[model samples]
Target: MFELLGIPPQVLFGQLLLGLINGAFYATLSLGLALIFGLLNIINFTHGAQYMMGAFVAYLLLNLLGIGYWPSLFLAPILVGLVGIVLEKTMLSRLYKLDHLYGLLLTFGLALLIEGAFRQMYGVSGLPYPIPDVLKGGQNLGFMFLPNYRAWVVVASLLICFATWFLIERTKLGSYLRAATENPALVQAFGINVPRMITLTYGFGVALAGFAGVLAAPIYSVNPLMGSNLIVVVFAVVVIGGMGSILGAILTGFGLGLVEGLTKVFYPEASNTVIFIIMAIVLVLKPAGLFGRAR
Candidate 1:
């Protein structure tokens, strides 16, 4: 079928697979962005830093404590989330009453500081994280050879995305969060600990970025700058999907990833700018974003 378009099946499917993998990361990262924006009303510029921290923590665990990717996979996010908890309690919490731009500026400064510290320590070179033995091989599927690790990344991302959506969009806890976002004073009047919930929500959002970081460590070089470029794309995804729309963020993340991948196959030069182009069109056509509800 692909041959009809002068493209090989391998080339076509390969790009698609790659796109899905990129989408997975985009989905996870953007979900966190939406969550923070929705519940906390803060734009966490530190998210990319937290993600870089996740990869660094994984690297540290493996080198210093003799832990591997599997254990670090779970531990990295938890550790980063804890750091987020501290930041929320000490810094982010105070900014809640201020303008949202203050939060963005503060977090952006934090991001730069964290990235600079890591760069000072590790230098600009990317440290390598080997793929685990369990996911070392690839299977040939006639059309293409599917990598075990890449498959795991996509599957894990999907599961994580769905699980987060279910938890936030369906559960009782989610109900409280929505209510609190709507009116914290009213929710507090009803006996919910809205303040604490806000803190946790920020941590949880940061943890998602950390989660993406851990997943990305093996695929890309684990470096301080790893999250820099990616976060811009995720920000674009948030805009395209409608900022603060959780499900919209997830769907748009994966959808754009596929679009990006296909662009690479069809028009290599345009691949880099395709997402931005979509963003421009979306801004003009639907400034509220594709899934965003107007206030």
Candidate 2:
């Protein structure tokens, strides 16, 4: 087996695969944040809690209702997304005219409250979610074995990310969303329901988070704190990609995942911090982020 940089091929490739998997999750999660901030102009702090809710929903569907993975994958997101829509209509809608800090504080409080409720109910232990029967195995690829589920994650995340980008950048409804964000009064005058669109956009963005959580349930132990643990890193990814850059989030996510993966191989001590180091460098050099436009 050929070695790269004197490291065993299996070890290097294995870590890279793991990194890609991590990146998939990062990309999926950050994409949601970008959409919410970009279109709705509200920083959703409850996003992580929403994500945790998705996983718990899936678990409940499986254990309580005897629903399996496939149905839960679609259903969990919708249920959680509807909750987001309600929150938007009742709470987040009120904060749009306020400073960004207000939106941030409100959502942040919501996140803490939601997480605390889940903790009180479930405690801190992780609940196991079984991988679906169809996606249970792995394939040997000479240098490394690839798990079917993880590969599905990467492919699925990429598809969802790209689809979202296309919808926002290339489609008519997406055009209305972008336009409404820029000038809601003008868009509303054009006979478009700006408030409704904003509400739907927030719901859709949150749905993306829920979708990621479903993908994550089997891989990570589903716990109340799961989303909290990953969210800080995902936020770091959003900052590095730019506050509202959708494409930036996707590319930077996968790129950082690879970088973090390789870091683990070359220098395990710095693996956890490499993304932040890169974030610091990016902040210093290009404050708008790699793909974000200067405001």
Candidate 3:
């Protein structure tokens, strides 16, 4: 097999696969974050906790109620999304008129409360989420073995990302959403229910996180701390990709994941900080991010 820069093709491809998988999660989570930020102007720090909640919800459904993976995949996001709606109605809505920092502080507090509660109840250990039987095996791709579940994750995430982008960018509903985001008063004057839109947008963003959680559950241990760690890297990803662009977030996420994966194969030590380093470079070179527009 051919080698590049002292790395074999197999190893490179394997890391690339891993990177793509990570990028899927990054893309999904960041897109959710970007949507919330773009529309609500709120930095949702609790996004990771909501993702953790999605995994826990799936676990609960399976272990407690005997629900299978397929059902939980759909149900988990809906449940978590409803919770988001409730939070927006009860707590988040109050801060809409306040300084943006208040929104951040409130969400940060919510994240801590959530993570702390789950840790107290479940401890730090992770629980296993079995992959569906149909996706149990791998395919030999000449130089490497590709797990069915991982492949599914990449494909499914891409589909969802593009679908979301289309809905927000191309559709009439998306036009209303953009209009509301830009001028809620004027949109309301035009007969749109701005508050309902905000609530649903938050719910939808939370749902995206839930979807990611279900996908991640089979790959990583379903732990309370899972979202906490992943959120930081995702934040870096959002920063690098730019907050204003949905497609940018999607592209940056997958591209960074590939870069990170290759780094792991060639220099494992740098893999951890590679994202932050990239964020820093992007900041120095383009303060608004690779695809972000200046505010």
TM-score (all chains, Cα) for each model: 0.98, 0.97, 0.98
lDDT by residue (1-295, candidate 3, tens digit) is 6778888888889999999999999999999999999889988999999999999999989999999899999999999999999999999999999899999999999999999999999999999999999999999999888999999999999999999999999999999998887889999999989999999999999999999999899999999999999999999999999998889999999999999998899889999999999999999999999999887
Model 2 lDDT on a 0 to 1 scale: 0.90
Deviation of model 2 at 212, angstroms: 0.3
Q: Write the per-residue lDDT of candidate 1 for residues 1-295, one digit (tens) a residue.
A: 4483898989988999999999999999989988888878888888888989999999999999999999998999999999999999999889888888999999999999999999999998999999999999999998898999999999999999999989988999998988887888999999999889988998899999999999999999999999887889888888899865678888999999999999999999999899999999999999999999875
Best by lDDT: 3
Candidate 1 regions off by >4 Å?
A: 1-4
Candidate 3 C-alpha error for residue 252, in Å: 0.8
How many collisions between residues are there in candidate 3?
Answer: 0
lDDT of 1 at 96: 83
**Which candidate leads in TM-score?**
3
The ten-residue window of minimal lDDT in model 2 covers 239-248
Q: Write the per-residue lDDT of candidate 2 for residues 51-166, one digit (tens) a residue.
A: 89999999999999999999998999999999999999999999888788998999999999999999999999999999999999999998898999999989989998999999
